[model samples]
Target: MLQNWKKIMLLAIPSLISFATATLTGTVSLIMVGDLGFVVIAVVGVTNIIMYNAFAIFSGIGHTVNYLVAQNYGAGDMKKGIERTYLAFYMCIIFALLIALVGWTMSSELLRWIGGPKSGNLVNVGTEYLEIRFYAMSFGIISFAFHGFLRGIGSTTLSMVIALISNLIMIFLVYALTFGTLGFPNLGLRGTGLAILIGEAIQVAICAYVYFFVLNKRFATRILVRIKWPEFRLLAFESGKLGMQEFSLSLSMFIFTVFVARLGERALAANEIALNVMSFGFMPAFAFGATATILVGQYVGQGKAILGRRAGTDTAILGTIFLILLGTAEFFFAEQIARIYSNDVQVYELAAYLIKISAFLQIFDGLLNFFAGGLRGLGDTTFLLFISLAVSWLLFVPLSYLFIFVLGWGSLGAWLALYTFLAVFGLAVTFRFYRTDWSAVKLREASPH
Candidate 1:
């Protein structure tokens, strides 16, 4: 029991650090742009929401690589593990390229439609930032493959190092370019996008180097010399199912943001700041969830369902405790945190209120991630897909719309609707985790025709 706890924390902490650093990069970027006025902040925030949903959908597909690699590694099939990783990596690139192409051509129009006519400067700046950032999606998706593989094989420290080095450098580049300092062009929002592109390229280079040098040799994990159509189809089909689950959730939130957009630019800016603060709780919860997926998947591969359940439960508990503490801080220090993002009095006060509301739901938020990870380990993505679609479309979308548009509650209405959606979704996921029989859950065989 003690050993399991140690194992989980050791693997999870580094992942936590990796995500924490990534979130920090976002927070700092928002703060830096906060000085440019609220419109620019809204531009960046809206761009992120679009890209974030895109990433979540594809990263869901990428994460199936983790599911595959962990199971294969536990079953002592290193060759098969690498095969799936290679497949996922290629698939991510192909899918991301399509998205990039669409974003390059259509992002401006999309922003105009979402923000409505009054969006003015936001549409122009957002389109510029989003297009350049879209160019980096392939690189980021490739890194997702690497992280998925690393987490699968329990090599999380390497993942941490990569994210830390790349994003830290990204910060420097964005800062330099945003302000035209350090010999970099001051492109404002455009500079931030350019910096992210460069940062992603650096990240991909590191992933490829480490993969070819260290991991490939250590595990003798071979790459694809030829495409096996049957294997590709199987991998894509399974991952696509998972991607749909991810897409449904992201799509809902994307619409929710559109409703927020209806509230005006300054309100959007405050929401962005509040979200950055929320990431403090969200990222750690995500780390524990990732840890649960890896650990639970490993135990499942070993035919130890009870052990998998225990790992999932323990990690959820620990994550909940950490979030409760963080939530308290968010509630208490809400004003200070808001000040970190904006000096505008209205923006800061609204952001502080949003942060306080976010604190109330941290417990449910933690449970959501951990249990969802457990389900992923059990190869239960299809179930998740159905649940997400049902809740997101049927309950979340209408309620939020009603609250924001009809009730005249503004941002408060959006947050209120969000609180209800998450609580229901989180509880639903937790219930499924407990009631299901793990023995009945089947994973794919490593060696496929």
Candidate 2:
């Protein structure tokens, strides 16, 4: 038990660091742009939510890479793992091109669907921002895909290094370009978007180098030469299903954000601050969940179903404890944290209240985050996806609309709605984790190779 704990920590901490860098990048960017006022902050927040959901397709697809690579690694098929990793890269490129094409053409329509005319100007600004960022989707998606692939095969540290370096570059670029420092144009929100694009492009370059020169060197030259179409299709189908699950979750967030937008600009701005602060605390669970997926998948592959179950449960407990500490800090330091992003007294007050709600719900939040990951690792995505959709849309969104919009409870009500949803969903996922025989659904047939 002690040994397993140690192993999970070792893998998860770095993964957490990588995931945290993304939120940190956004937080710092928001703080810099906070001076632009509430609308700008709100716009960025909305854009972040949209961007995450947009990326969910790739992230969901990447799960296929993780499952396959981890399983292959455990089965002692290093060659098969490498082949799947390469295929994921190719598919990400293809998918990213499609995203760029569609997003560029449909940016206004999408924003209109979510934010309406009152937010139309903000949406326009965000669209321009997304346009610049979309150019790099291919690189970003491929980087993410390879990151999952490598991490699944127990090379999580490599992904961490790439993420850290990419985040540092984004920060520096944002400062340099947004402020017109270092001879770059001061693009503001657009500049921030540009920085994200360039940084992701750099990450893709790094991933390619590692995969082609480093990882490929470790495998045979023949495997490196081949791009197996049948295997690619198999992985893509599985990934597409997972991606749809991810899409549903992200889409739910999009809907919820739109609901907040409807509560007026102040509410929108407050939600942004509250969400960012909450992200800082929830990151550990995401990291731990990533580790659980890898470890659990590997265990299942190695025919050790009992070990996989134990790993999932143990990781969940550790994640809960870690989040509790974070939640406590957020509860006590809510005002201090809110002040970091907003000088408006009203925005600060509202954000603080929301953060308190979020802090109290951290344990529930962790359970939901890690359990979903654990279940995914065990190839239980069928149940996981349906549950996520049901909980987020049917329960969370409905309650949010009722309490915040209908009851006139404002930001407090919105937070309360989220808390309620997390509590219910978390418990259900926990029960499923304890009761389900996850290992029974292992990939019975090999992805065509």
Candidate 3:
């Protein structure tokens, strides 16, 4: 158990750092653009929610690839692992193009629907940002796929390094382009979008180098030379199912955000601040969740069902500990943290309240993330898909409506609904984890056609 804990932490901490860096990048954006006022902040927040919903579809491919690669590698099938990576890469390109085309064509309409004409400049700003950012989907998706591949092979440190460097470049470019510093144009929100694009493109380049030259040399694996149609179809089908799960979750959040937006710009901006701050505390759980997935998948692949279960248990323990400590800090410093994002007194006060709410829910949040990853790693995605859809759509959305609309609880009411959803979802997944025989599940056997 101790050794498993050590191993999980070794992989997970770097993953945590990578995820934290990504979260901080967005925090910096909010901080830098906070001066643009509540409307602009709200616009960025809405755009981010939409972007993530779209990206979640392709990100599912990365998660699926991670499970496949880790299982194959653990089973001493290096060639199969390499093949899975190539298939994921190809699928990523196709999906990226499709997602971009759809986003580009519908950005204006979507923003208008969310923000309405009364949103004034917010709609136009968000639309333009989405249109520009959609063009970077290919690069971002490719980078994510490579990150998943590396994580599966126990090279999370490489992914961390790439994420760190790429995010640093984004921060610098955002400052320069937003303020017309370093001989760049003062493009404001558009500059923020451009910086994200260039940064993702650089990450893609770095990942390509690592995948082709570094990893190839280290693992003695060859690049994509052939397509395996059967395996390709299976990967696509599994990823698509997982993608639908992600899409459902994102859609729920998007709907929730739309409700928040209806409360006005201040409410939306405050919600964004609260979410970002909550992300910091969530990072440890997120990392541990990814750790659970990799370790459990690999152990199950090696036919050690008990070891796979042990890995998940150990990860949940560690994640709970980390989140408890972080949540304590968040509870005490909620106001200060909120102040970092905006000078608006109302926004900060509301953000602080939401942060306190989030602080109390951290443990349940950790449980949900850790177990969800464990289930995914065990090739139990169907259950996760069903449960997530049920909770998000049936329970969460309705409760949110009742709290915010019917009862007039506003943001606090919306958050209370979120807390209830996470608590229920966490318990459900945890029960499933203990009760189910995940060891008998085989990815290849479960493959569609």
C-alpha TM-scores of all predictions: 0.97, 0.95, 0.97
Best by lDDT: 3
Q: Candidate 2: deviation at residue 111, Å?
A: 2.9
Full ranking by TM-score: 1, 3, 2
RMSD of 3: 1.5
Runs in model 2 with CA error above 4 Å?
A: 221-230, 438-444, 447-449
For 32-85, candidate 3 gives per-residue lDDT tens digits of: 988888888898898888888888877889989888888876787877888888
For candidate 2, the per-residue lDDT at 91 reads 76
Q: Tell me the lDDT of model 1 at 271.
A: 90
lDDT of every predicted structure (CA atoms): 0.85, 0.81, 0.86
- Candidate 3 overall lDDT versus native: 0.86
Winner on TM-score between 1 and 2 is 1
Backbone clashes for every candidate come to 0, 0, 0
Instruction: List where candidate 1 sits over 4 angstroms from the true fold.
Output: 446-449
Clashing pairs in 1: none
lDDT of 1 at 160: 99
Between prediction 2 and prediction 3, the one with superior TM-score is: 3
Candidate 3 or 2, higher lDDT = 3
